[model samples]
Target: MTEKNAYQQAGVDIKAGEQAVELMKDAVADTYTPNVLDGIGGFGAAYALGSNYKNPVLVSGADGVGTKLLLAIAADKHNTIGQDLVAMVANDILAQGAKPAFILDYLAVDKMRPEVVAEIVTGVAKAAKASGMALIGGESAELPGLYAKNHYDLAAFAVGVAEREQLLDPNNVAVGDVLIGLPSSGIHSNGYSLVRQVLGITTSERFKDLPIAMQETLLTPTKLYAQAVWPLVEQGFVQSMAHITGGGLTENLPRAYAKTLSAKINWGSWPILPIFNELQAAGDLSLEDMLLTFNNGLGMVLVVKSEDTQKVISQLSQTNQAAYIIGEMVNGQESGVVFEGDAPW
Candidate 1:
């Protein structure tokens, strides 16, 4: 007769997973705000709701780290990727003019590595706290046979709330509204699949020398915009906002607005980040392709009336966020974003 062990017998060490959670206890605690009801190691996490706003509408978004995972694997730096995971969802919901309430993370790994797991979770907690969100619940799974030893995946879900009147929509955008652009933290999480496909398997040192600040820019985590845009939204200064993600500016701006109005962007108004230039040179990617594919340099954008534009910029500046007056809304047959000259790509 043979004695059987737990999943630990099959290389998935439950004890090691538990130990990993124990190690992350302190780091996770550092992210807690008044709304977070418990620590990270619970089956369920709780939050206080219904007491903060009138007719609080809950907005939620779930997103993963995307192909940027390859960079983490290549550099062996897992912490910042977790922040990217949180940023993806939180920033998306923030575009709707909602204040983040709580966050939940999901981590799946081929094997249990206490240190690496802790580092990744620490990053998630950091972003959540930075956005004034509570890290309430999450799941960690260890599957030895499902993945390569060095492979893992991370996903995050964030919930936000706003009063019905506080919500922003493009319907409020008039032809005179100005387009405000927010700077991105480099390549962000999109187009990496294309990046790796173009660059292939290069050494980290060589990856660092690819014309731009590859190491710093590539490792740049996603921008969390909740704290920066909340005040503007609360003051009713922002008419509508867009979070540039998978589709670049052209695709995302039409989301919260009606198609009858079009946006004309001034290419020279914003400075294109060096990383984008390098990608253009390296891949010889056309201007149109680049504009449709990446955020270029702008991450989040706020649309405001001409009268309120200065106030919006001043408010954003006070929050340490630089806002660019990229262009203005215009009349067009189509209801999408249009480029007047060249996109600042």
Candidate 2:
């Protein structure tokens, strides 16, 4: 075996990894539920499955921040990206009518910085606490060549649980079910590749040059819907749900529809966010592309019976979440989303 005298010269820093662990350990501990059996720095984290669930089904989702990380990097914002990470998976599990139980993150960087790593973990901890999930453990890796200095990537895996009978099944979604649109907190971690193209800015550009509102909107963290949605699920008002992520309404909404049903989204039913409008005009993007790309405004769509629409909206309002009756599921020619009226774009 060849002896390598200096691992630091090769760009991997063992001490930095240890420092990161020390910095984030307390924040990680803050997300622990009574079920969490072990803390951070364990070779493997453990969480006891409580006996509360008789027929519990574990719902798991894995997601990354995508090009949105570039925006975060550009803005020198590390905190909100963790919320985006949790929202991406927690909302997915919520769509299935599950309660988020625990989350673990994977953060990889070319060089490790304790403060940066701790800032990211703090964001994750904030989100995990919001979702009522334990931040059991995670890995922070320093891969010198894979990423550039000051550049890092985040990916997270979340596990949720639902009683078998409580799981939201798309098959339960039927014709005439109304689609309720829950307004997003800006972009919510998707469609940024086009956003950057429209703005024509590099990752290093300070967002300060843009209008303050636009900058804030772009950096707003993804909203966690669990607190609002869980109640509706328990009340048996929500039939199904779709987390509008990468595919926007064009792709995601269909995931919750029965084969016999197609979603008819009413154009102009909800207000489209200004950031989306800015992107469309700047990019000269067509209505088709806009609908297929950005979320426009709606973040998560709840499919409910027509009679239950007002109830759901009213409940969401209590949480300071404004919702709209954006559309309905219909027995149409095909099983997909069909936008009604002229394109708002």
User: lDDT of each model, Cα atoms only?
Assistant: 0.83, 0.88
- The model with the greatest TM-score is 2
User: What 10-residue stretch in candidate 2 is worst by lDDT?
Assistant: 200-209
> Which candidate number would show the highest lDDT if scored against the true structure?
2
1-345, model 2: which lDDT tens digit per residue?
A: 655549877988888889888888888888898999988767998989889889989999999889888777777779888999999999999999998999999999878888888899889999998988999988998898898758899999999988999999999998889999999988888888888778876656555577777777888999899988898997899999999988889899888976677998889899988888888899999988888888888899999999988888899999888899998888855549887787866
lDDT string, candidate 1, 234-300, tens digits: 8898899998988888888878567878888887888888778877877888877787778888999
Q: Which regions of candidate 2 deviate over 4 angstroms?
A: 1-5, 206-209
Error of 2 at 101 (Å): 0.8
Error of 2 at 111 (Å): 1.0
For each candidate, C-alpha RMSD in Å? 2.5, 2.7
Per-residue lDDT value at 245 in model 1? 88
